[model samples]
Target: MSDIFEYAPAPESRDVVDIRPSYGLFVNGEWIDSLGDERHKTLNPATEEALAEFSYATPADVDRAVDAARKAYDSVWGRMPGRERAKYLFRIARIVQERARELAVLESLDNGKPIRESRDVDLPLVAAHFFYYAGWADKLRHAGLGEDPRPLGVAAQIIPWNFPLLMLAWKIAPALACGNTVVLKPAETTPLTALAFAEICRQADLPPGVVNIVTGAGETGQALAGHEGVDKVAFTGSTEVGRLIARSVAGTRKKLTLELGGKAANIVFDDAALDQAVEGIVNGIFFNQGHVCCAGSRLLVQESVEDELLAALKRRLATLRLGDPLDKNTDIGAVNSAAQLDRIRELSDAGEAEGAQRWSPPCALPDKGFWFPPTLFTGVAQSHRIAREEIFGPVLSVLTFRTPAEAVEKANNTPYGLSAGVWTEKGSRILWMADRLRAGVVWANTFNKFDPTSPFGGYKESGYGREGGRHGLEAYLDV
Candidate 1:
């Protein structure tokens, strides 16, 4: 493929980011060593290169961070005028915009996502989230929740590695905007950007302890989520983990919100614009190496057009460039971690064992790094694990339906219902489908589209509570 075009590698220069050799927990607006000596190395999935080492947050360290947040809330952040808090948030948003390129490069380096997506999609949304929530800071009384919504103090937020910086923004911006302080733990695999965000808080002159960053894995998140001082817990990851956190916080007064896993369905009707629908299908599943919680991992096409759509979709998959997260032209980058890649392979193999036909384009992958070729499984039954479970990779399972009612039934059959997409030219049909889908978000002709002002979450085992929009404010509020 390279010989055909003689394409040169256009790797984004990592010189844009200055990652520290090691990092400590950010507590009370200062960097301090962990109480324990245990440390873990954060690696780049693209090359398995050690990017940085970060100390794990011990239970004591989590307590210190939570205490700091609580102290800040009681002494300063809670008493701070909404207008003043808005100014701080606005400054952070402006700084994020100014350093967009740096954050994008760092995000790609740390998380193994294409620089194009990090630069164009994640960074922009992160800044916009802050800007959007900044406006809401001073206007909560008019947000329809109550006459005067009050902040839930000392929120503890645990985010996933898939969209490290963007998830940070999603968790932090609204929590801060509602006049609450936060103790946030970035996923152990992708903590660089969050540490960099601590720098942003310092640049904005945010009050000490107003925002703290703890870098660690599941144990650290467990400690933070179960801490008694924390008033609220917001988590984004797997539903299994969400259940554990829910149990840990049970019988407590702690308010909780979860944005967990999904196995979204992208439906293509015979009347849809075939070419655009194919594009949506590709973007929905292959974007971010299919690491999205709301990724359209399943394709439910009207039976009349299944063959045509599958042929067109395979052709589109052939054109996807997979390699080098720093490359400007790469479409699919490395999977986030070795564990995630193995999970994808296991589920894809199960798809084959369960009698589904699997296919991939004749594209060569890099000898090094964690990568999975864009794949699609046809003749997938609802009983197939590939169709029922979240693969979280660049894989799609295709199924067919005979009627709108059948499509609705098939799409809603999953245990997860975070998001769904329907492609059709008929406006009435689109509305009808949207009204019947049991998901938080429905895209009529588009797929994987997001906005800072729009609420996004899930139903059923996909977890509860919404993030973004006016509804997002309620999660951190005590009306």
Candidate 2:
């Protein structure tokens, strides 16, 4: 046998999933044809093959979805007791766990993420989000938001392509737990999981019109977010789009919460464990092919251990296998789409043009799919586009700092402040850095860690409001 670490193809079976040839809007707890004839193909990013064709919801469709949600809110879901809602949430969680493998396979096929990640990380977290919120369903009075927290009526939720199912759970579970009806729109590129989730809702025997899913591109999302019938609007995507949503809902009575972009900093001190820090740094940026909104794309290292860390990190990156997303052994997967890959290339090219040294290991990419190597940029200045902007790809920009103050200063320098990571053996220094960092979520000695019980959002341009825990309930509730 070859070396244990040597990559052998162990592709997951796709036979478990049955992708429908065509899909439609899930409105009033039923799949219905779109009002408009506009349709788009949902592609398998790993193979560039069209998996299925799905509808693009027109303005009328959005109105229908919003109206359905409104009716559900006023008639059934909104008036339902928290205990009854919890039963549906719990049932959904159980069904998701039972269908976990199917969802994982579909997610990898559709979203172009490694099977290891979708199976282990995304699906588990998706179930956990539902389970977590289920526990909070009947306990709103003690949630500290208010003595009697009421549902916010119809909520308009739009999720990104990166973590489709998990983001859906994040938006839906809390809204349902708080007894609010929702009309959700998944990203144009990755709507399969969301549509599957609508099936889950049906399976769970959720009330009609309680949850509506309309799949489409930007214009459909704009219609949903700007719908006057929506009592609250929540979105997870680009900051530019977040700003537009903020502007669109500015004067409306709608309560809006956004979880947008991030250019997070992962700071490693000289005193940190070199091996541990190296793993953390790699995971921070390269996990999910660095498509995460809060990915630690910026590595701020202490000047003393920069060389040592760089050498170790480079060696680790060389071992990473990038190929079929369905391959269980693959570490890096394809970029989500041609357009996203193009954006990554444009920004990476800009990094090289602006004087940063870019390096990639010997990654033999697949011929057909959208692929980008696990890239690293040393000598990356703070002003460089790679350092300042969210590449949202498998790219890490390395910069150096001298002390805790300097690390905090450099880490907080970006317009995005969603999260920051610190790796240091010294407890006091980690505490100090966490206190000083301007990001919403700061991880000490760990990166990209999330729990449904903990509230997550960001500061400034990273967008406002929290999405998990009891705080997440506040967004969907009227105190």
Candidate 2 global lDDT? 0.94
Candidate 1 Cα misplacement greater than 4 A, ranges: 1-6
lDDT of 1 by residue, 1-479 (tens): 45566468898898989999999999999999999999989999999999999999899999889888989999999998999999999999999999999999999988999999999999999999999999999999999999979999999999999999999999999999999999999998999999999999999999899999988889999999999899999999999999999999999999999999999999999999999999999999999999999999999999999889888988889888999999999999999999999999999999999999999999898888899999999989999999999999999999999999999999999999899999999999999999999999999899999999999999999999999999999999998
- lDDT of candidate 1 at residue 432, scale 0 to 100: 97
Candidate 2 local lDDT, 269-352, one digit each (tens): 999998999999989999999999999999999999999999999999988989999999988998999999999999999999
Please give the distance, in angstroms, between residue 77's alpha carbon in candidate 1 and its true position after superposition.
Answer: 0.7
Candidate 1 — worst ten consecutive residues by lDDT sum? 1-10
* Candidate 2 TM-score over all chains jointly: 0.99
